[model samples]
Target: MAVAPTPPGRRERNKQAKLDRITAAASELFAEHGVDDVTTQQIADAADIGTGTLFLYARTKGELLLLVQNAHYASALERGRTAAAGTTGALDGLLALLSPVVECNRVQVDNGRTYLREMVFGDPTEPHHAEALSIVAQTERAIADLLSERTRLGGEEAAAMAGVVSAVMFLNLAPSATADASVPEILATMRAQLAAILPG
Candidate 1:
């Protein structure tokens, strides 16, 4: 049976309102002026919150970005899920699942290096960082499920493949100083790597 969601209390509602305002303000500022140029003070001012309160919500600028990106990443994951549902091929489905996330990350192109580093090694105690880690684990599980159901792979092998694919996805997300690589190139490389383990 389905359970209903709990109603937010006065305090929880107020906190959500504040978070919504902050996320909207940060998104607008980051859009108008790139993430690197926008300051936390400006974001606070735009959100009509005090600088100290901003710190309570997000300790650093990168964390602020993570806060702003929370909804966008969730939306991307939904889109990936929809795309994956329409595919039968294993590699193709996994790529479809990750494509939306990659595109979303591209929007923060200039902040890739810092964002990627913080996302992996940032303070786990922070709410937004914890959400990011949860999302990563969720994505990996989704991939493993696809492999197990659609391909001729055992449970353990499917999970191992998910880990390898996760590694490739992270490496691709990492900032590169060289010329840009398109999405096709990135997926082609991922497919080749996965082919080694997937049975024919």
Candidate 2:
């Protein structure tokens, strides 16, 4: 009798299952306790895994936070990209691109603000700090590409515009406490600013 072969898909599924558990547990713990306060032991316990198992998924809490942050940004960017694809005008594409940032802000307004603060003003030499910067650069490039496709701007001009849009969006979505303003107030201010800078 020949032994049945283990399917490749099954191995992939198992790997994803483990990853899903780690992510979900981390999300819950990080949201409740804040990233700095949360520990791999707590995450492992929450996910019903051994400490060694948690390390297998994430060597450190900072790395795990980076992973989660990357996942969130990627999802939001993909949504914005999809929305922009349907728009005709450059401004419309920009607005579509902004939609996901707004949505993400709404979903995790407090946490988003906290993470941004940590990334921008915290220790710059940290490994995750560089990773965060790289992610922002990639996001800027994506926005630049969208603008270039929809407008007559040169690559430098497109990138500059995208950077401006990104800056405005970041200011708008910044934590109210940090800005001494509310979300609506910041967004309204940003909208007016974008209008002044971006050509119709």
Candidate 3:
């Protein structure tokens, strides 16, 4: 007979509520104005929390963006995974697995690029930055699983290929030279690259 897990106490609950408010405020402000144009004070004000409280959650604007975008990226990855399950051909399945992420990143292009930048360059010791990196790892694992199943590749080989695929996806998402490209255009380029890489 094991005891049931304890529920969150009042203090923990209050902390969660504050974090939720901060995430919501940052998400809305970043979407509306892009991360470059938004300020931490604005986020704190929108969250109805003080500036000091906001700093407790995220030290920098980039970290704040990571905290907000990580949730969206995680959800997009799940949608892609679901879509990939019903997909048939290897290329089609790969595309299915990647499409939602592309859509998510491109929704607010500048914000999307900035999120990528932060994920790549922000302090790894930061919790939000670590979460962002974790999502990227999850995405790679999903891709590796699909590739191994469809292409008969060994685990190590599949994971290596998945890393390549992830790189291609990020490059297309954050390309400085093609910042204005549409989702379809980015997908088309990715498809061509994957076509060359995948077993025919």
Candidate 4:
């Protein structure tokens, strides 16, 4: 027989509850009004927590955005991974891996772009930012795996090409130049770029 794990103490449970409230409040408000228009005070009020308490969880609005958007990005990546797994051709696999991500990013275009900006420029020491970086690494690893399977590339070659693919995806997803582009349009551009660079 095996022993069960200990349950969280009251303090730990309380902390998790507060974190959940904060995440939900931020998610709803950001989805409704976009991050730019939503204030921390509003989030705090919505969560029924004080502004000071909110800062205890996320130091800045950008970090809060990361905390919220990271979950969405993670879910989208899971969907993409599943889609890619069923895909056959190299380009198709890559597009399948990226399609949901592009759709997620375009849901509220500014919020998505801002999330990318924060992930790039925010404090790496922060937990939320670190988690965001980890997600990006996971994405690259997934792409590299797909490349190894579908192409002549493997090891470092696959990894490097995966990084390039990631860059192409990010550029199309976040750039001011593509801000007005639809999800399908952004994906079309990515498909073209991948077709040119990836081995047939």
Best lDDT among the predictions, by candidate number: 4
TM-score of each: 0.87, 0.71, 0.97, 0.98
Question: Could you tell which candidate, 3 or 4, scores higher by TM-score?
Answer: 4
**Residue 76 displacement in candidate 3 (angstroms):** 0.6
Better of 2 and 3 by TM-score: 3
Give candidate 2's TM-score. Answer: 0.71
Note each model's CA RMSD in angstroms. Answer: 2.8, 5.0, 1.0, 0.7
The best-first sequence of candidates by TM-score reads 4, 3, 1, 2
lDDT of 1 by residue, 34-67 (tens): 7889999999999999999888889998899887
Q: How do the residues 1-200 of candidate 4 rate in per-residue lDDT, one tens digit apiece?
A: 99999999999999999999999999999999999999999999999999999999999999999999998899999999999989898999999998998999999999999999999899999999999999999999999999999999968999999999999999888789999999889999999999999986
Residue-level lDDT for 38 in candidate 2:
81
For model 1, where is the 10-residue window of minimal lDDT?
A: 175-184
Model 4 regions lying over 4 Å from their true place: none
